[model samples]
Target chain A: MAEAAESPGDPVTASSRPLFAGLSDISISQDIPVEGEITIPMRSRIREFDSSTLNESVQNTVMRDLKAVGKKFMHVLYPRKSNTLLRDWDLWGPLILCVTLALMLQRGSVDSEKDGGPQFAEVFVIVWFGAVTITLNSKLLGGNISFFQSLCVLGYCILPLTVAMLVCRLVLLAEPGPINFMVRLFVVIVMFAWSIVASTAFLADSQPPNRKALAVYPVFLFYFVISWMILTFTP
Target chain B: MAAVDDLQFEEFGDVAASLAANPDATMVSIEDPGETPKHQPGPPRGSGREEDDELLGNDDSDKTELLAGQKKSSPFWTFEYYQTFFDVDTYQVFDRIKGSLLPIPGKNFVRLYVRSNPDLYGPFWICATLVFAIAISGNLSNFLIHLGQKTYHYVPEFRKVSIAATVIYAYAWLVPLALWGFLMWRNSKVMNIVSYSFLEIVCVYGYSLFIYIPTAILWIIPQKAVRWILVMIALGVSGSVLAMTFWPAVREDNRRVALATIVTIVLLHMLLSVGCLAYFFDAPEMDHLPTTTVAPNQTAKSS
Candidate 1:
């Protein structure tokens, strides 16, 4: 049964690892590999021992990727095809999404001026922490993906949440009644589910069949929290 | 039926006694599902009855037996029944309260803190107690002023006072409940996740109301300027706590929504604080005027 469960051909059953066992294994394996070879090569001039300037080729690639991300922002909603694109670490998409989320959070408040710094910092930290935590969990569960790659996938997965946030903002403009709430509620739920499914789809490949649920649980929580924040946005 | 009523009364009396014995014992351990609650600080507190029922297999018995047992056991509406909600440790409650008050970023500490410690009882009771205190003190102050006047003035209407207190207390939980429901609905709609339970939201809201306890206590001062200062402090502490707690939760791609949520929460907190001050603390003075005018007439008639 375990062998059948672990079989690569059985995608449906492969990731359904026993919850307690997987959790125990992850906790016990404290020395799990967290880093891999940097896939995106630096194309810039060496500026310092730690910091290097971006080379023209690398800069061009990033610019091109940013353009692609912009052109394919909608791909984040239906990210099955975008999985191939997410394989290359395009930090701009995540960065833009993070900024957008932060700005969305700052809307209509009296203390927006004073709150801007902390709000942005809070959003950035949460996103990075969530990505890192999910990455660590995946790695501990024998995930094959690199940390940066996982971060990219996780970051792009927030697009549905972004959409949900936008819809919530629009919905809040209307009178707050059951009908308006229902509409906001419906949009957020759909987007939140999309985000979870999308993240799981992209990230779940590396986990063993039994540990898959364990891996997806955090992702679900991450997106659900974001969706909830957006949904409860009462202006 | 008579036997069952006797049992019910006896159980109720025991629960009341236990509660009176340990008024501060808010923690209830639910570590063992099947076994009766053993770590309850005071007396056994009715879980023994549950264990007995389980042992008798009365849980799965025939309808008549179940009905008789339930009647004999008392309806599941007692304080002990709700004690399960206060499952988190007292130390953890303090930790969460601290975290919610000073929510530094990086790990989304408030969110994680809340997720880990999902207790509703401590906060619920604390808020209820604060509101109740404010209500009682307001009524007491009014009653005292009326006594000082020595006029057969209209006493503070018990019905109105009780209803007002109940409404204010209900608002403490009701608003949070509504927001929780909205958030859950949104979570289900958007992420298809029910991340925080209703109790967890209640827990957060309850802890957030900690500032109001002091404010409620200060309401009895009868000085408007001093009372306003206390109200401001209450609003500041509670508002900041809420902002810190909810910042990470509401932070999203849409700045408007996040700002709106924070503002709404703060405004709601302010509204409740101000409303408590306006209705419970300050209104007794206005209510005294009508009574003072009526008191002279009543005294004259009596004389």
Candidate 2:
């Protein structure tokens, strides 16, 4: 009787079949040994699956490659995936409202004049502050964070920023010459680069330094440039 | 040839596909300590090569939840994740500039110098000399001519010339903006630092001009408040200049950072404008002041 179709006595191999063959449907049993997690899902559901119908070897290769890519990109921006106060909305909302209010007050000052108003130093401060305030709001919105939490994040991130500014000021003071401008430029550049990397690091460590979040001088520069160009050139 | 065919790595295959993609890679025995994790090998039961290969290679196409069967998580910013959110070329130019600025030996020298002194002077001196030379060469003649003119309060001839020059200077500034933008696009990623740096310098230098300009000219309201307001505006602009020019680490674009900047600038401008109005125009003084305030009842109320 055709040798009983080669049926074996092995308990787990009653009707032995290759794990994968010409079958149209595939069920993947993924068990991460290191993590001790077992996940069984359809092969077609996997975003990284090679194709609608792929062989075992091909599937293995795709998963490995995907893991590597995800790890690299993920680490590039936030190494630790930690939370911070900068994600708080309560703190930012009022802070933003205050800034807006301040600007409105200034606008009133301008309206007092028919030909235009006098220049005020505090106006520029408000401008710089605007950049920081807006950025905080944007992060909170994107991060789905509480307004108050974002304020805390800002508090932490601003530390490195303050230091960089102080250092730049000190450098400029020592020179007070034409070269001072160059030094100032250099300081700003260095501070920006440092902040980007530092923030990324801070994001990784759950206990990010509140003092560091204040290092936003670089973002100011970006706004200053873009806005200045638009204001000056758009006409 | 047979080996390549036998190792027929389906384009969208597993980790093995990664290995297959790199034909030059020497395949070590799977038993090698480094080749495989130290954990016990999985049961050699199923023909999983194809299944695993498909999983690994099809990552991009796989819209499946990173958490199996779970909903995908959204990131902090939706716009930031958009494919074209960043202009890549602009960043590349920025990178190129950074690369040129940081040569190995030169970088080492600067680092060591800074480390020893913690404040750079040698480079500052060199840069100063160049700036001084340029400034003097470009403006000395104008300086002398201005000094020669006895009617300094408001020379009609000079004012006309200056108005024309102001227009030209404004035009000249555009060149830097465009060139910088182009450069940024070339190395869009690097644009992060270069663009910010350029903007900072402009803020600083632009405000510095006020130091030389007559404060009285800014008097649009009453005299007392107008001057004070002007001074404040100048200072605020100067601060922005200083912050932008001096701080390099401020290049990132987080949501909070962007918002802070916008609010700060708008408020600053508003404050300055208000002060100017309060100081420059003496509408209330019309009835009180014998010389000005043509309108009636204005001065009595202001006093």
Candidate 3:
């Protein structure tokens, strides 16, 4: 019976039998020998810097990389499990989001002390610090993802929050009243929760099951503090 | 060699097919069946090897499950099919009133208590009683004014006063109901704060009117200065109660939202008090009273 189960042309019976039911549907059966050396194709590797590669024009290389970064940004916004886009770490999205958020925060308070506005350096430092802190926590908790990849995910996750901040800035344009307060409150709350969920989805893989909840708490607190700041931002 | 290759391929296919049939089967374990045990024979350590293997081996299934779970849990505000807005014991109303009158932290007890035991019964009755009291007092003051003038004012219009009082009182409740609706809509979006239900809003607004009852009673006091002093005192008391009750819920995270809520509550309270004072207490000037003789023999005298 076992020998019949192993027969090449008897796949239907083999698949129907419990003994051969452990296989993934995607894997195809083909007769192949295991004695000889088997070669597995490697995924495309990121090119390393070399003198030969340096011969390529800087502008052309930068343009090509930028295109790749744009694709990665789109992937982050509408994530696809099939794509390994997070592997292509890029700083452009993070940088843009950080600056935009800071500007949105500062726009409402333009009339205050001219220097009181959120300085770009200050905003960048805060964003960097938060990302690094979360990355370090994740790493210490058994996250095996690369530091840059985690940072990229963390940064991209701020997109919803950035949109929230923009909404708050617009809300400030309305007369400060109960209705206005309600709108601002609603935006911040939703964005804050979104940020936490999005970050956890990308970064919580390395955490043990027992520690996952504990690890997610800091991410929740981080987004909450940001949300609070955005909600309270009055021009 | 080719025949051996074909045989090996068939074995591989059999394993794959078996895996497809029973995805949870232990046959997928990467531990080599023929190899001797290594290390402590415990769960895999975080040396990155196991994770990499898992990622490479089961990327599709893992991601599909994760995405499915995420999509399933993403809807934050599910429709509440049945909601009980009012549910509080009669005795708790006194507790709520006492709590509302306490200091900032003490007021949080009222908020927490109200949150747990929300009800409109106490607040509704309290507001209704105050409105009725105000209407009755306004009629009493009009009767006194007529006696002082030695001419009975055209049988004091109880209907007009009652209608006005009812409209104003209804507004006192309506505004809060509207505010509750707005808060509910807002809560649906962000869902950070535990939202107070419609009944809770009414209860808070009702308890806040505890001070207004005294102001309504004092309306019959003929002295304008004394009435104004009493009105101010009433405002102070009710405003403090509102601040105490609402502060804890609003203060911690969003200062702007807190400010807006406080302003709305205070404004609504003041509008009710002012409307009561203006409509019920501010009797029409004697000069505007069209002098007419009820009796042909009686002479109309100017005061």
**Each model's TM-score, in the order given?**
0.37, 0.22, 0.36
Candidate models: Cα lDDT each: 0.58, 0.32, 0.57
Candidate 1 per-residue C-alpha lDDT over A1-235 given as tens digits, one digit per residue, 9 for 90 to 100 = 3333233333433257775565455433421222111212332222332442344568776677667787546666666634564465676788888889878865475744432123556567768876886676566445678888888878887888887888888888888667997998899899888888777767777765544665676677567556645664554
List candidate 1 segments past 4 Å from native: A1-235, B1-84, B94-115, B143-148, B152-157, B185-195, B285-303
Candidate 2's DockQ: 0.01
Residue A10 in model 1: lDDT: 38
- Candidate 3 positional error at B162, Å: 3.4
Model 3 spans > 4 angstroms off: A1-235, B1-90, B100-106, B112-115, B188-191, B252-254, B285-288, B292-303
Q: Model 2 residue B165 lDDT? A: 34
Predictions ranked by TM-score, top down? 1, 3, 2
Candidate 1 residue B189 C-alpha distance from true site, Å: 7.3
Please, what are the lDDT tens digits per residue for candidate 3 over residues B1-303? 323323433444445444543443323222222122212111233422342233333222322222122122224354211112222323345556665554344434333445333544456445545755676666555545554353433233334434654765687578777877766665565543334555556677777776666677778765567677878888877777766665644555366886888888788777767767777776543442546523311221111
Candidate 1, B202-295: lDDT as tens digits: 6767777776766676677656777788889778766776666556555542578668878998898888788777777555444335444675
- lDDT by residue for model 2 (B1-303), tens: 222322433322355434533433322221222222211112122322333233333342221111111111225365433211111122222222232233233122111111111111111111222222222222322222233233321111111222323332452245335434543554454434323223323322333333313332334223345445665765554344333432232235444654564445435434533433342232232222344333323332333
Which regions in candidate 2 have their CA more than 4 angstroms from the true location? A1-142, A199-235, B1-303
Error of 2 at B130 (Å): 31
